[model samples]
Target: MPLANLLTSLSALPESGSRDAYLRFLKSAGDAALRRSGGPEHVTGSCFVFSPEFDRVLLCFHRKGQFWVQFGGHIESEDASVAEAAQREAREESGISDLVLLSPGIMDLDRHDLHAGFSCSAHWDVGFAAATAPDVEVSVSDESEDVRWFPINEMPIQVPAGFGARLERVRHAAMSQSGTQIG
Candidate 1:
C-alpha cells in the first residue's frame, strides 16, 4: 500500500501545530509511508470520536499507556484510506460501528515519541474525527482495559497531558466542522 495519496491527503491539511512534522514524515517516507517496519518512525492512524450531541467523547484505557485515550493504531496493508484505518481502529476498540467522520480532510496531525515497549521508535499519528450517537453502548476490547464515555468537561484525568491538549483542539475542530459552537 503506497501512501502517496495518504501523503497528499496529509499535505492538504490546513496549517496546524503538528502539520510541519506530519509533512516531514510524508516527505521522508516517500512511497514507504504505509509500510513502516516499526523501527525508528512509523505512520499511524487515529480517530478522535465525539458524540453527535457534541457533549461527550469515547475513550479507552489503553493497556500499554494505562490511561483513557482516544481509539487508533498503526495503518495496515488492507486499509484503503487513513480515514478508513481510523474508523476501523475506532470501531474495533470502541465496539461502535456507526461512527461518522466529521470531515474527509485530516482533522488533526500528531507526532509522538513511543515508549520503550512498543515496536515503533516513534509514531507519526494522523488523526481523524468521528461522530457517535449519544448513549451508544461500548465494550472494552482486548487492547484496552476499559471503555466508556465521559462528559467533555470531566474527561478522565489520567490521559497523557499531550493527549488532553490535543483532544481539545480536536473537539473544537469537530464542533466547527459540524456547524456547532465550540465550548
Candidate 2:
C-alpha cells in the first residue's frame, strides 16, 4: 500500500494512543519505511502548562493555520532523553521560565503523517508538565503566531479529533501524581 493510503487509514482510526494497534499497523503498512529512510523518526515533546490563577493552560498558536498546540519539535541528536528534549523545546519555543515536568517522563505517543509530496511518518512522544510563575512575556517564534493561556473549558475548536481525551488522561495522571485535585 502507498504511504498516503496508510496515512488515510491511520488517520481514520480513533487516536486512542494504543501502542499495540499502532505497532501492528506500522508493521503491516509495509517494511519499516521509517527505518529505511535513514532519518530520525521526528520525535517531539510538549508541556501542557496549567495555571491556577487563570484556570487555563498555556498554548501556542502555530503559524501554520494558527493551530493551537503545546510546545514541541523534532528531537536533536545530542538529546539523551525525550523528556529533556521536550523541556528544551518548550523553553526555547515559549521562553517561559521555571517549567516543571508533571508526568514520569513521556506522556503520549503518536505518528504524524506529513502529507508533503511524499508521505513520511513523524513519531511524537509528548511530555506533560506544569509551568510555575510564568513571566507572561510573549515571543512569537517561527513556529507559532502567538502564545497564551486559554481557559480549559473555552479552548479553541481547532484541536484534533480525540485529542481532548488524551489531554484529560494526561491531566488526570499528573494531578493524581501531584496530589492535586482536578478542579
Best by lDDT: 1
lDDT of each residue in 90-145, candidate 2, tens digit only = 77777765565765344555556543432344553445566555456746677788
Off by over 4 Å in 1: 36-38
- What C-alpha lDDT, on a 0 to 100 scale, does residue 26 get in candidate 2? 53
Question: What C-alpha lDDT, on a 0 to 100 scale, does residue 24 get in candidate 1?
Answer: 74
For residues 1-183, write the lDDT of model 1, one tens digit per residue.
337667678667777657777777677776566556635687778988888877888889999878888899878878888778888899999988777677867777777777877767777778889887767888888899998888888978799767777888888888888899765
In candidate 1 the C-alpha lDDT for residue 179 amounts to 91
Model 2 lDDT, full chain set:
0.59
Q: How many residue pairs clash (N, CA or C atoms closer than 3 angstroms) in each of the candidate models, in the order given?
A: 0, 0
TM-score of each: 0.91, 0.70
